[model samples]
Target: MGSNDSEYFSDEEEAWVMYKDRSEWADITPLPQNDGPNPVVRIAYSDTFTDVYDYFRAVVAKGELSERALQLTEDALHMNTANYTVWQYRRKCLAHLGSDLEKELVFCREMIELNPKNYQVWHHRRVIVEWNGHADKELRLTEIIFSQDAKNYHAWEHRQWVLRTYRLYDGELEYVNRLLEEDVRNNSAWNQRYFVIVQTTGYTQDVIKQEVEYTKKAIEKVVNNESPWSYLRGVLQHSEKGLHSVEGLESWCMALHEAGNNSPFLMAFLIDLAEDTMECHIEEREEKLAKVLEWCESLATEHDKIRREFWRYMARHISHKYSV
Candidate 1:
């Protein structure tokens, strides 16, 4: 919006008022919105909103792309930020007028601060950044947003786009580590770690080894935590090397199981490993089926009784599949 422009301010006072009172808009006739006959529910629009939108319609109908038109869009947006049509018009004005995209970025940052989850505002910011090619501040903006709400999906998505588009992967791992340290249960951070790894260095052997060790430490810290276990499984899957490739994973799970840790995720992981083993080693199909049945029975009768029927069904299916 224009800063302290006399056209927006009343002559006698300093307050911004309706566009009808502005001398600059006097030449254009305001076009009021038609509600059609017998509206279902008439919106009780304030006079200011009614007047602003009336002038907005006039300007849009005329297809005006001037400074005043830009300011008018800003006014409409301030009242209703979610109005995607207003945002689109504003972008057109910005491009037609060759407005300073840097200032536009600042405006978008302010909008994000007010409502980080606003989809249109984020899309506008992305478009501006794409045009300006200045994504240096995007990371910090997303970090600030994440600090406020770590699980904000929009912020995470925006950060990923910025990072991937700008190749800003230098400190992303450390950033993810910091977030994970702050809250180990933050599944978003765990997923972000996977994304950063896959996008940048990929799941190389050394990277897989580091991730496996990382997941082990994380799971050891909290036996019942599901995030790290899921990450571990994802890492193994991406490696395409199967469970045996991890060397100590199966034994580690067995050790945890022997120590009386009956976490459902742990059991699920073991079941998956056993199923994989059954496919790879036909000789051990009977033995693996027995182990699977034991665990499924244990889960149905003891640990995860709420899913008893599901587990029982699994037991039946596994037994029938292998003729155990």
Candidate 2:
């Protein structure tokens, strides 16, 4: 059965009968799997799966690029979507037969919907889309997948590929903004925002300032959220003038720290800023390093006890750096 045969019986009894009765497959001899005598482990494949793969092996060995061979591959994939060899063979058939790529894309979409996290399916979709040179449907498809699963790594990877390859920068920031509005802690959405900025206008001064403000607002909404804090550091890293270049950022961080918003990520950001300050001003190196050591101690003792060893190590490292 082809991938389009959505109504094909999945029952082993019915599928076995269906495969045996098909006259179209009479010309090809089906190859059965060989397990050596006294095999330590033997797989008990379902009847339908066995029949489909037996015929698949036969066609693959004969180097057949016929419609029936293509259908047989689809049948095998329906049984085992994770089979990389079947997907590879299907691509070869599609290429040789000059099949309708648009229809193939639809098939791929259906397969992806069925198995969103399947690496094989996503790779197949990517290859087909690259061949068809139409990435218009990708963003929407990924958005739908994201609605079902926000952190689907495959969907995020595919969406980024589509945006980068097609130069689909228009409204991408808005799309990311909507995602962030739904969940500010989504690191993927925050990363996508960074990607869009870097790929499009780059980190111009104005862009950096705009992103800093955007990240600041996000942090304001949730002081403990790490995504925006990470984004804030990333944006400022691109600035020629470093962390202090962004006006009120240092004082604001101090204010948050003093106000008892003792989030580990907030403390870490402050330590980073203090280190930056120490580097830029040799006279204040001891004082800034002392502040860094203090925060590290706080993290070790109170705010983030899980990483106590890491925080203690940071304190020692800062002390050694200043002393040397």
Candidate 3:
């Protein structure tokens, strides 16, 4: 059987076939669902790299854009999905060939499974969704991709575009909450939460007030994690209140600092709060701001040596703490 198999596969496509229990979707298309040593591509074709490459060149040479041109491009992409030119040409062919875009979405999703970070595949997938106008399906597919890699910029960008284009911001905050519950250190999740909040509610004080309570819970969860602290600063910075204007904010930082956290971010946040509360040239609250900044400088310099330069830079640049 092995010797006879050589007759069907091209030199580049030669591989062993191991039968396994296939899914109901197996007939849908040939994209491998499992990975193993020497995993062969599921797209069984006798087309060789040389043959596909030659045909692609011939089509481009003739400027012939048709459905027949897709076969050679697909074969080439099967070997190297990163080829931008091939993907661009394929898009042109796809549009002119009257090809089935629904099937193309399936193919693109399968390719994404092989390498989620492949730019061309994602670009092509985005183009198809935009052209076909399946906002709901695009949202669902992007959510699945985000579940696989929460911090994937491309996936997040696509999700944002889908939500904005379709006005689908209803459940995004809840989705972000789920992500945060899974890992509080997920900065991307925190960022997404902020995005959703802004998209739905804008920067109104009520929204900021609600977000502040939510953010404080996260900040106090792990005083050392910088992501939530950054999120807290970002949302609050856009609010009507200054950073330090939040009730008991200073004492909370003091409590966290005294909890033996040695967290540069908490200290840094407190330092910003103190500086923001001061008038630049009025000298009011200068004593309080100076003391807070000096304390943060000393703490960061001693315990967080990694960011000591940053603390030093803050001290050198900030004049709010100094008396006028």
Candidate 4:
């Protein structure tokens, strides 16, 4: 087969037949081709993928752009939902045949439910949504998917893309708050919270202070959890110059340290906050800075054994930065 493959918007197909109870043999039927500028299929593959590939390979090569091609693409997509070629060809048909954008969205929604993890399925939906221009349902879809599986990276990524693309930030923070209420350890939820803050206010002093109070309570609820600690640092970064000082973070860290929680991230962030204080010309208490630096050395050499090298590097960087 030649390789005049789907090049534009190209990326990275299957079908099935049962033979005997033993080894399965694949169907190798050749697909129909239209007499047009291109009249041949040019994809190469084997096994369960050949039938759908063969058909779509020809449908696309022949530059078919009618309702027939659209129907065939729908069939081919059922066999291999992630085939970008089928998706691209389908888009062309949608345009050339004047297909309804809402109907296309419904088709893509079905595909997404059937193949949630398939990047092509989600990507195709994004293309359709970009055209359809009503992302309210898309946002709800992401939220629904995340509610069922909070850690689904694909769903979370799509959610982030949808919100950013549509500027649908209203209620986004509250949604994450509800999610965190269910599970504060959900780092994705925390990241979403941070994403919303940065988009809304660049984490102004008031916003940062509010988030600090929020996360302080969150971290207090779970001593060794890292989500609150990480989000606190992220929000602090956007606070006004010298305005992001670790207000209650030190007292919390001291309590955690005294309780032998000894969380590596807590200790690491504690030292980082100490450095941030020095940089901001806040009254740098040498004792406070020295205490966290010593904790960093201890964590690097003893406690945080898994990330020993990372903490060691942090220690060196801090020493060099402050001549400690």
Candidate 5:
């Protein structure tokens, strides 16, 4: 049998028998040629998505081709939902067609139903929601995704973009409140809340309270020292609120203390934090550095190298007059 053997043998009746257990197999029983110009060559090919997608694209690029290209792409997706290239080309084709926008959105929604874990599909769904929905439709779409996966960064980022791009923060404070009530320690959600709160309402004492509480909650989520160190860096980066407060700093120090203070992770965080600080504030940081160094002293003898290095660095900083 030739390579076209399966194609010739597969009729609707036989297709079910050959492909009942293999849905990806296409019944390519040849139809009568339409007797049109540049008639398609009847080349034997596999039923794989890649082969069909390539053939569809080739025919689509031909001048004023028929709707068969779109049909072929759809067929390819039906055969293999995981074919990202097929989805990509379909997106491009839909984007260029003014009338097919709704159809495109429906197709993307189908893609999401097929594979909810696909970040790319979620992204495409976002685009469709933005185009199809009215004033608050995008937010509704975002809510749908978050409900399915509260930790989805793609969905979170998309929500942020929708709000910021549309300046839809009249409800932002409400949004932050909802997140706090729901997950309490979702860092991505917290970060978005921080951005929305600061930009929409400006930093205030209330903002400080929330961030402090968030930091505490974030610290609790960590079973190791690294998370607290990571959380502290986030606080330091966005200190519009009083995240660098004495209480917050102490909490951070306590986290390191519990991790043996001089664990390589603690030392690395401190060193990195110091590097990010300005030389002019080297003296100003000495007090906190001393506090950290004191905490480091409790480390076991085996951890001496990290403990000694940080202690020496703090001592040298205390001796300097560099002021903030």
Candidate 6:
């Protein structure tokens, strides 16, 4: 060895290494830390800026010790690298931003590796990507994360953030169309698409009209299934207009009929939709309510408990709203 190395160990650090050694899944990934400087240094609860700076200066001379400094600061600030103080300290300590940026990116990437569902870290990583390179860096990281786990909610959220922040929608909905093709059930992507369309340059009336028709056709294509209903409900939940046209409600009722009257999803949708959409003036509200009540009555003989609860809840709502 060109440079001499000194062995150091803290009791807390040793305990963690021992725990990692005993776990079966320990081989899957390298441990975050080992028997080095304690990752959790004994900093005072009310430490000042001088205290933090002095601590960094003291340990930064040793390469191994300085590496631990990043870990300790990351922990202290709870992974918020954007904090002005942490960013400044990191720049001061690392001296080379290219290496430092990579290290910071690695910390976030490691967290993404460990828990792909953490959108916050993914977002923070995007900020670093912005600082280091072009806007495309964020999308590249998002694509990498999504490739690793397609169903990762955090990754989807990160993608949406990148697109929205960049104002990256095409006029013909090309971006959304491609995204939905990736995963039709990607509600996060769908919601992002909706946001883009709503915010895009267009007359408000034209946008709303087009959105309504687009949504209607989209839901109509899948209304015979439960996922469609769930998707439709999500869309309707965000729209100011109601999805209570006799045609649409009747389509849902037909789905309930095809499902043979025992689908908890349909019943739950009916109950929640009725309550939530009461503010949306529908010419067919009473008719839709009658259809749902008829379905509940059809189930009364076989499912006494469900029927009783369903009818009681509906009756209470009706009483509160209609006064008889």
Clashes of 5: 0
Model 3: lDDT of residue 133:
80
TM-scores for candidates 1 onward, in order = 0.91, 0.93, 0.80, 0.78, 0.57, 0.53
**How does residue 7 of candidate 3 score in lDDT?**
36
Q: Write the per-residue lDDT of candidate 3 for residues 156-241, one digit (tens) a residue.
A: 88788888878898888888898898999998888888788778888677777777788879877877898988888887788566
Model 4 Cα shift for residue 93 (angstroms) = 0.8
RMSD of each: 4.1, 2.9, 9.2, 8.1, 8.9, 10.8
Q: lDDT (0-100) at residue 188 of candidate 4?
A: 90
- Which prediction has the highest TM-score against the true structure? 2
The local distance difference test score of each candidate is 0.88, 0.87, 0.72, 0.72, 0.55, 0.52
Better model by lDDT: candidate 4 vs candidate 5: 4
lDDT score for residue 283 of model 2: 89
TM-score of 1: 0.91
lDDT of 5 by residue, 208-242 (tens): 55655665565455434454445555555555422
What TM-score does prediction 2 earn?
0.93
Best by lDDT: 1
Clashes in model 1: which pairs? none
Q: Which stretches of candidate 1 lie over 4 Å from their true place?
A: 1-14
Residues 113-224 of candidate 6 have per-residue lDDT tens digits of 6556645556666777666654555566666766676557777677666666776554426755675666666665566665665566542445544554665455544443
Q: Write the per-residue lDDT of candidate 4 for residues 44-66, one digit (tens) a residue.
A: 54333454455556656667687
Cα lDDT of candidate 4 equals 0.72
Off by over 4 Å in 3: 1-47, 280-286, 319-321
